[model samples]
Target: MTETMNNVLNDDKKWKIIQGDCLKVLEGFAPGSFDAVITDPPYASGARTQADKQKSTRQKYSSMGDNAPPAFEGDAKDQRSWTRWAAEWLAEARRIAKPGAPVCMFIDWRQLPAASDALQWAGWIWRGTAVWDKGNSRPQRGRFRQQAEYIVWGSNGDMPISRPVPCLPGVFKYGNPGKRIHLTEKPLQLMRDIVRICEPGGLILDPFAGSGTTVLAGVLEGYRAIGIEVTDVYAILAQERIVRELAEAV
Candidate 1:
């Protein structure tokens, strides 16, 4: 590793959160710097038309009025644009990951297909999709409830069956966080469970660390983690949350 990369990972803590464009920050890492990639990226869904997609993330995803979490960037892309962008980041992430490094990306139903395509287009072996059943959601009269998100998981290449990881579940049942600091923040325990896909004490990366859940979980689970968040507000929030939560856990 380069001097700077080593310094960043060997800091006082086992985790770090970098604030910048993920595409740009991801380029700064050395090849094979990480053992896994686990993240919940902006889905850029919840709308149909291009104009609708351009709405602020809060407007597009929440209805809590002024009480909602702050809006984030990079969620305004249309389908084609989002797919291309996903491919670029996924390719970069794959480059930074070690051989056989596992990757888990969270996405809703709307972008599930595109996410899988991006994962393969970026040269990672396509594994299977896991479900995150929220257990509850606003019920629709005639249609099914949208209570589940997906984790599209795979490996860099040739993940050996002998890798020191446990048998993980295909479906995770967890409710959403009751109090969220980010609009699409995921449940912390869910993140903790997901980070186990990496071998113990391995390093992990989360290119779209909206709230640093993956980074925090990795550290708590005995692995190193690095998170990249583009939005300034969320970058600060994520860092603060991770630090505070880690301190409390200790």
Candidate 2:
């Protein structure tokens, strides 16, 4: 079964979506095996309390587990412990990625400062932050509109640019497709834009490859990619998505 699945993935030219804990899965990879990492890991938003995520979404996960598509896991760590947990896997990702490999990690405004600190703690050079502005944001009476998320991006060491893409702006304005493949499904366009930051035709690693958009973007762009998803159900979905994408391209 494993070999057969591997062959299917290879048909897409080395785009792999593995089902396992990212921290455990990444351990098996040889040091510096990948050129870049563009991923969205679980945001440690709460410690013991569940993140105040949409209750409707939470209900879907609880009602469907295994029988239905996998729900979002992680994201419940408190600010203090979450940083420590993130640092561990981030450092691990660094070990697996080549020096000067670029990394882009996603986070909400609430977790901004801590996440930035985590990246530096993991030995990544803190370059700058990019904004993903979700067009048509929800506005509250007193609070500001909650329409933007951030990408804390940087290089493993020195910034390397063998294949140069046009300079992109710090802010991106795109709207959600309203399709819930995953509760927090990012736009395909967003991933396409971000993948350009990676080395052309180089191997890309997405350790927290929820729904596999990052890996899918890499493969579609002619780059080899490995996406490790902790939830096996989502792993299957991700692999299928990639396969379908590959077929559609042909």
Candidate 3:
């Protein structure tokens, strides 16, 4: 699987997006193969009940009705199951990440506690949380607007303060992209900023490629990156979008 990844990266010197199960694909990497792990995994948190949790990704996330993007996999698990699965993959990601490598995982309020628990269970040093204020969301009659998601960030172990990375903000404000190819696509600029947590030119790993936003952002910011996506439609779509957008920027 890593060899296949290398072949893909050869087509574009700085980045690669592989189509596979991240759990299995991660096993192909050697210990300490990556400098950082940054990804927005499936939150599995858009529902109030277990039955609602099993609804399709599009049904849970999209307000566009029939125009919703294609549904993706791995977002239907219940809370316990999602936490266990998160810990399992996170452990694998840590195994491949260099010592002191930073990790940033995206989650919503419903799963924030679980995500933090899973991170510590996976053996990462729980650093702190960062906010991604989306700037707008549906206002409720009396409750506060659910207008933010969190990045649960940490490190493999003993991240030295001497690292050259900048002092990043604890909060980022960015609206969702006006157009999206995936059900939960992040803004490209948000990803570019997040990738800065890695040292300059370090390789970053994003286990959930979604629309390949992280992979593209990494390259544009002068770092190498690899992304793994399981859904076939998105794997193809991400590759095309990365190739086209990169070419256009040239």
User: Best candidate per TM-score, number?
Assistant: 1
TM-score per candidate: 0.97, 0.86, 0.96
> Per-residue CA lDDT of candidate 2, range 1-250, in tens?
3234323344546788888888877777777777888888776552334545423334533344554444667665668888998888989989878988899999988789988999999999989999999977667899889788899998889885554656777898889756657767788888988988887788888888888899888878888888888877788888888888778978
lDDT of 3 by residue, 32-148 (tens): 889999999999988998899889998999989989989999999989999999999999999989999999999999999999999999999999999999999999998999999
Pick by lDDT: 2 or 3, better one: 3
lDDT of 1 by residue, 170-241 (tens): 999999999999999999999999999999999999999988999999999999999999999999999999
Q: For this target, which candidate reaches the highest lDDT against the unseen true structure?
A: 3
Please give the ranking of all candidate structures by lDDT, highest first, separated by commas: 3, 1, 2
Q: How far out, in Å, is residue 95 in model 2?
A: 0.9
Model 2 ranges with Cα > 4 A deviation: 1-12, 46-69, 161-163
The models' CA-based lDDT, in order, is 0.92, 0.79, 0.93
Q: What shift in Å separates residue 72 of candidate 2 from its native position after superposition?
A: 2.3
Error of 3 at 174 (Å): 0.7
After aligning candidate 1 to the native by TM-score, how far in Å is the CA of 105 from where it should be? 0.5
lDDT of 2 at 60: 35
Model 2 weakest lDDT span, ten residues long: 1-10
Residue 231 in candidate 1, Cα distance off native in Å: 0.2
